[model samples]
Target: MKARTDTKEKIMELGTDLVESIGYPSLSYQQISSQLGIKNAAVHYHFPSKESLGLEILNTAIGSFEKMISNISSLGLWEQLDTFFKSYRKHLESNNKICLIGASASDYQELPESMQAAASEYLVLVKGWFVELLREGREEGVFHFKGEPKHKAAVIVSALAGGLQHARLVGNLHYDEIVEQLVEDLKP
Candidate 1:
């Protein structure tokens, strides 16, 4: 796997920043070009279309979380789970908006297959991580489950994501509180 050139990485990094700040629906290549102090052609040279750029940006953001998830130690899975949820809550606090998954899923069906695939892959990864963690906890007798851990892990991931969306919808939901409550419930 060849590393991306600095300029190409810069372009993608800028694209992610712009999308997070302005939003994907309102993002413009012209604005990105202007922000980079380059001609629109430069932006197009790196990304042929806005959708392609959006996908790259989304992938980059997801890659960050993947790195963090991969870094989690199996020796401390419950602690790792708490850290993951805490990090997620911090993201919500900082962004003060729905996450990429939440926002993208809202209109996911209308998006290109690549974008939809990206969103689907994220949820799959989250569920996969939860399954691993939950299984570890159950093996240690620190977690009790009425059903299969894998199935419950999927349900928990979906519920946590749904909770975030609900918090965003209700306007007064506290993300930290929700996350803390989730952590408590997950504890043995």
Candidate 2:
């Protein structure tokens, strides 16, 4: 029983790394199996399909983001925003990979319906988190943005996600400048 659980986890972990480094469309049970020294049939037994594994990866990322959001409630408005920026930077710097949803979005039309829905849900989750944070920041007089919190949230999320991609290509120093300017512009 423990061995079964361990194998499943190994598949999930390596699947996620592959998807993040490459992309969902390029991932395969064969690749995972080769990396883990397991037969491709073993991966099939656990995941059944690529879409199933992709969905699980999306859910795991979403769950982790949700926990991060929950923990930020105790932080100051500026601190919360800064923390978000730093987290995004950390993700890119550590792995040189874009956020899973962002990477999946590039091949969104090619993805299975279930995987597409999971990616959409992940975007909505991040946008919703930003909306709440922006609204709180406004109420607290820490944010001086001129638009609706929802709109502002969309811009911020887009900028960070897009910026990560740009940074991946150009270099982290340039990305840092752009992000620093973004955070600066949001100040009251």
Candidate 3:
């Protein structure tokens, strides 16, 4: 049982890496099996289909982001925003990859219905977190932006996702500068 769990986890981890490095449509069971030195049948035994693997990957990424947000929930508004930017920078600098949902979105139409729904849910989860944070920041006089918190949250989320893709081309330093400007603009 432990071995089976480990194999399943290995598949998910490598699958995620492949999807992030490339894209979901390009990830193959053969690639995962080759990387893990396992038969393709083993991969099939665990995932059975690409849709299943994609759904699991989306869920794992979403859960991970939720945990990160929860962990920083008690921090001051400014600190929470700082940590959020830093979290994105961490991924950008380390992997040069956009968020899983962002990457999946490029191939959204090609993905299975379940995977598409999972990706949509992931975006909602992140956007909802940002809305709450922006509202809190506004109430605390820490954020000064023109529209409703919901609209502002959407802009922030879109900017970060766009910035990550841009960063992959122009470099993380440029991305940092963009985020810094965003933070400054948010200041009350």
Candidate 4:
């Protein structure tokens, strides 16, 4: 049972990387199976279908987002904002900035219904978290953006998502500059 669970997790992790880099249409059971040193039948045993595997990958992303939110619960407003910003930087610096959600969102029409719904849910949740963070940060004078918190949140989310793609092309230093500009722009 433990081995089965471990193999399932390995599939999800590798599947996530494949999907993030190549998008859903390019991901396949054979790729995951070959990469993980397993048979396609084993992959199918766990996921049963490509749609199931795609849904699992999205669900994994949702779980990671939830964990990120929970991990920052004790932080003050400024620190929380810093942590949020740093999450993207961490990914960039690690050279893992290619985002599964970004790829999923881009390939939305190609996805199964379950995967589409899950991807949408992840975006909505992330945007909602940013809205709350920006709202509270403004109330406490931690952020100085002029506009509705929801609007700023949307802008930030879109910028970071777009910035992630741009970084993959223009390089990390440029990406860091964009993030620094965002931080400076929000200063009171």
Candidate 5:
């Protein structure tokens, strides 16, 4: 039983590495098996199908982000918001400045319904954090927004994702600058 579990884990790990390195659509099972030094049938035995493997990769990626963000601590609500954004920025910098969840979420519609549902859950949870922070900040007089908190949260997430894409495409240092500016904009 333990050996079976380990094999499943190993396959999932390889799948995640392939997705993060080459992207989900381009990740070939045969290539992953070659990298794993195993027969493609071994991978197929564990995953049954490519969609299953993709779903596992999606789960692992989202789980990793949740674990990373759950570690931040702050004394006050505003400080919590600051810590959240700052920690996220640091995560981006530390992870080669890549948006893992956002990248995976982009391919959700193309994946199976199970994967899309998982992706939607992760995205809604992330958006909820921003919404909570924005609402709390406004309540405490630490933030002023012209729109609803949930809408503001959506804007923040979209802008951040858009800025990252622009930075990648334009080869500019303005990405971090834009994120920092948004942090300030979230202030009262």
Candidate 6:
């Protein structure tokens, strides 16, 4: 929309990175502008408010995660689980950033009403995917867990989220242990 023609995209890219790397509440137009070497008005021009930016990030994250889950839908059960675990691990390489789900969730109370709704939608989509995956995997004898799929899925998701946060304070070993034990515990 400007001479750069990708300023809006760049803003969104940096915006989300900041949200995941730092917390969403820590994100600021000034911080974004400083990182992108643009003026604060440049960010403001595209996103009139922080809520607008947060909403856009959540929407984009939902679409991205939907696509990711679908892409791995054809894989073997264990492979699919490995891919899912890898997604969370990828963030550990980048300033101890957690997944967007965890980042947005930590700020849920501070989010605007619309942002909160989007966050809830994101949660449902992810947890639903995990629940279905666990159900199918167990039915196929790929997993040997002893709880309702929904309950187990919630525990897995929450542990991974918390593991990422804990990784930042301690080290990645704690995160790796969580992933390993999760898979081990689900073994046949």
**Model 5 spans with C-alpha error above 4 angstroms:** 1-7, 65-70, 73-75, 82-100
Query: Mind giving the per-residue lDDT tens digits that candidate 1 earns over 61-115?
Result: 6788789887876547767877887776654565455566766777576668898
Alpha carbon lDDT of residue 141, candidate 4? 89
Supply the global lDDT for candidate 6.
0.90
Checking candidate 5 for backbone clashes, the offending pairs are: 142-188
lDDT of each: 0.71, 0.86, 0.88, 0.84, 0.71, 0.90
Question: Order of all candidates by lDDT, from best down to worst?
Answer: 6, 3, 2, 4, 5, 1
Q: What tens digits encode model 2's per-residue C-alpha lDDT throughout 6-116? A: 999999999888887788889988899999999999999889989899999999999989999889879888888888888888757666778786788887988899989
Error of 2 at 124 (Å): 0.6
Per-residue alpha-carbon lDDT of candidate 5 for residues 1-188, written as tens digits (9 for 90 to 100) = 88778778888876766665456777788887887788888888888888888877767766776775566434576667666556545534543343545666666556678877776777787788789878878988988877899999998877766665566566436567777777677666
Model 6: runs farther than 4 Å from truth?
Answer: 1-5
**Candidate 3 residue-wise lDDT, 1-188, digit = tens:** 99999999999999988887788999999999999999999999999999899999999989899899889888888888889888877768557988786787888988989999999999999999989888888887889998998998888888888888888889888778878888987988
- The Cα RMSD in angstroms, rounded to one decimal, for candidate 5 relative to the true structure is 3.2
TM-score of 1: 0.78
Candidate 1 C-alpha error for residue 89, in Å: 2.2
Most accurate candidate by lDDT:
6
lDDT tens readout by residue for model 6, 86-145: 987988988898888888788888888998899889888989998999999999999989
Name the weakest run of 10 consecutive residues (lDDT summed) in model 6: 1-10
